[model samples]
Target: MAPHTRYTRLAEEALSPAHSVIATSQTYDGAAPFPDFPDDDRPAPARSGGERLQVAVTALIVTLPFLALGLAAWLLWGTLIRPTDALLALALYVITGLGVTVGFHRGLTHGGYRAGRPVRIVLAVAGSMSFQGDVIGWVATHRRHHAFTDRPGDPHSPYRYGTHLRGQLRGLAHSHVGWLFRNDPTPVERYAPDLLADRDIRAVSRAFPALCVLTLALPFALGWAIGGTWLHATTALLWAGLVRIALLHHVTWSVNSLCHVVGRRPFRTRRHDRATNLWPLALLSFGESWHNLHHAEPTSARHGVDRGQIDPSAAVIRLLERLGLVRDVRWPSPDRIATHRT
Candidate 1:
């Protein structure tokens, strides 16, 4: 059977229905999810023209900013750093970062809540602006990660190498960014057939290229309009466009690399699930560093359940819930919290 078919048969019962509340923590184990394609290890196909174009543009976007920032730092000695441009980049970073945290991770992949069509579109576009992979692909890969975690099939596990000094360094590199160059592509059909089946989500996935162009161009245009100079446009592109994405990307990826191999496991989970809570990263990672609780209560609307663990993303979700933009939130219950607590 195809991956989707297998997933439907295996995961249908496991998945909480749209907007349904999961009352207990036992669902994750019961719903083992669509198993990885153990027998289907055929070589994947090459990238299409659009994919190649995206790769080229993404590379340019990722590189030119550093060069610009470096030259400005050398020649202008930090004088070129505009307050507005820096603030613009920070604003976009928060918006797009939360888009990934709330929309892509919890709302889509884990089904922690449901949003209306307008809210969904906004979230998708904001996530795309971050220049992460399109929503469809991102959701697929992340869902696969939750299903396998530190086990063999995880796309980017820091523990892939044994825990030794040299091995850990190599694993950190692999988990951080080295996995991008690998040939393996997570099969979307098996992991994210639900998202693929959604017309709105499919449309957003199809618009990733256009969204990338808009995101970069928006900052440049804003700078030019606001400051009225080619230099200001370049500066905006450097800080807000390129730097913002790079910063957010590293922070998000740190959850995969740093959170797993370090920090305190304050919650119980599966036997081999080595995810941990890295408090230092809580603020920057937008609450995603609480990986131990996340793994234990995959559907909980809040990851930072502890008294003082600040979860900005969860706060945003709560604000939206108050505004009636998102509904059926799966906030952790007292019993569920007690069950997972170490």
Candidate 2:
């Protein structure tokens, strides 16, 4: 057996009985039941244990080269330290990194803040560099996750399996990258109609592959311009290119795996979800570690609402508002926060 289309199967099994309105299903009548529920019938592909393990092992192996390079760099730091290299790494990291946190996650996925037309396009392009996927695709998948959460339909939830250690480890790996290879993708029409309807956004989404190439190439180009050597270019490519992306991937995925599986859920969510605020990823994930608050109040501009919590993404939104590039901000009120407290 295999999974069929998400809405199709869902409508057939649980739509009318559960609710009068079918948001994802196309069929609608003023006073009649849905006559056509999409038959969620699809072929089930088979894979050997060795083949599955091969995928897991390959993910591990792909990361090793970057780890080795980082170790080597650390070992030779003083001798190899170069001002240009340091600056290059910092610039790329901040630009591309914030592009993911601010642009992809907050702007596209949740609509936490609105950017001006120019900023919106630029952020979309920058986010494409992180190589997650196009803005529309990413938004659709993420919205689906929020809609279903840790329940049966969640695209990636660590709690899908039991809470044992082995289950946790396996679920963690699945949420991190294994879900990408899965056949199912969120139905964009249902989940991301707003993004799909925008022409400029569609243009950027279509250019994603080219943007990914530009992302990897730009660092080396800058390195060669500054250091005037192939060696510097190679090192820049390694550290700011592969290593930067690898680090970002894990940090972003940790929100799905580690945040769900551990940390403190101070706020109440749908009974099924176990969102938590894991402090260590706060800065790296741009205050997205305040996952519990986010799941509790998805559209709110600020996630780090606690006394000492720091949300850089919210800070960026504030700055954008100051510049008049973003408006209709939705900062969470203390009263609202208190209401959601568990």
Candidate 3:
């Protein structure tokens, strides 16, 4: 099947009432049996050398950026931050952040809008630079999250351990970053078959490792060229490359942890779907902290539908639409928003 056709089919399936039934039926408490997937049905495979290497690599990827904080602080203690490094960090953060919010989450995962081939590819590439994971895997895991929400099948729900205080604390850690270390994997074929069928998307997903290298290398190269010093290059790699990535990482994870556990639920969602509108994280998360409305209407392009809510991702989508780069945007109307309101 054609990529666009598959996308349309998946979008329809996601929005269909039947899909809601499937989601609701899958809901369970912690004691429920493991989800019925091929991976879970079979005996677990022994860890291979490659698997160990992957875990090590994942640890490095997750912690290296965070370690850069200490290095950055040391650098700051010695001298004032270079203007170029700060500016470069800000620019890359915005670009890569929007790439995730608009590209991976809104467009590819939910079909909030349809972009041309080039635009879609560019967005995928940009999002890949954020070091979140390959585009296909990211979409798959997120789709699964939506399918089960805070229930048992969710990949990273803070309520996974139950509603008790200690369980919530443990679940918060699990939802925030601990889940990345788990052996469980979301099946791309089941959750993101549309993306898997797209040649361009597959190409971008394959290029993820290269994009990860480039994301760091670009800052170093630019800093050297701009400042003509190795010191400048080092700082830029630290600030723009690692520190910026770390910041975005935590902010994105906060939407998973904090947004679900604590925040105003002004919009009604599925049973046990405790997504909330976290205003404090609105700007940092590119408006994704408006989780209540998003869960209420998954395909809506504008997450922050109410007044005074700053949705930079939605603004970027609107700009792309006006520039003729994207079409068929699913902007929610007032009536639609009202229907979801508490």
- 279-323, model 2: which lDDT tens digit per residue? 999988889899999988887778999989999988988999899
Q: Assess the local accuracy of residue 88 in candidate 3 as a C-alpha lDDT between 0 and 100.
A: 100
What is the Cα-based lDDT of residue 224 in candidate 2? 84
lDDT tens digits by residue: candidate 3, 1-342: 645456656754654334433342344644333343322345456678987887889899999999999888887895888899999999999999999999999999888888999999999999999999999999988887887777756779887667788778888999999888777777788778888878999999999999999999999999999989998899899999999999999999999999998989998998878998999999999999999999999988999999999999999999999999999889999998998888
Q: Please report, as a residue range, the 10-residue window in candidate 2 with the lowest summed lDDT.
A: 30-39
What lDDT is reached at residue 280 by model 2? 93
In lDDT terms, which candidate is top? 3
| Candidate 2 error regions (>4 Å) | 1-81
* Model 3 Cα shift for residue 341 (angstroms): 1.1
Candidate 1 lDDT: 0.77
List candidate 3 stretches off by more than 4 Å.
Answer: 1-5, 11-44
Report the number of backbone clashes for model 1. Answer: 0
The most accurate candidate by TM-score is: 3
Q: What is the C-alpha local distance difference test score of candidate 3? A: 0.86
Pick by lDDT: 2 or 3, better one: 3
lDDT of 1 by residue, 1-342 (tens): 632233333333223222223222223332232122222434456888876775676567556655655655674674557898988898888989998998888787777777888898899889988887799999877876776666556678775665667767887888887666555677788677777878998999999989988888989999999899998898888788877877788888899899888899989987668899999999988899998999888877799998999999899999999999988788999888899887
RMSD to the true structure for each prediction, in A, is 6.7, 8.7, 2.8
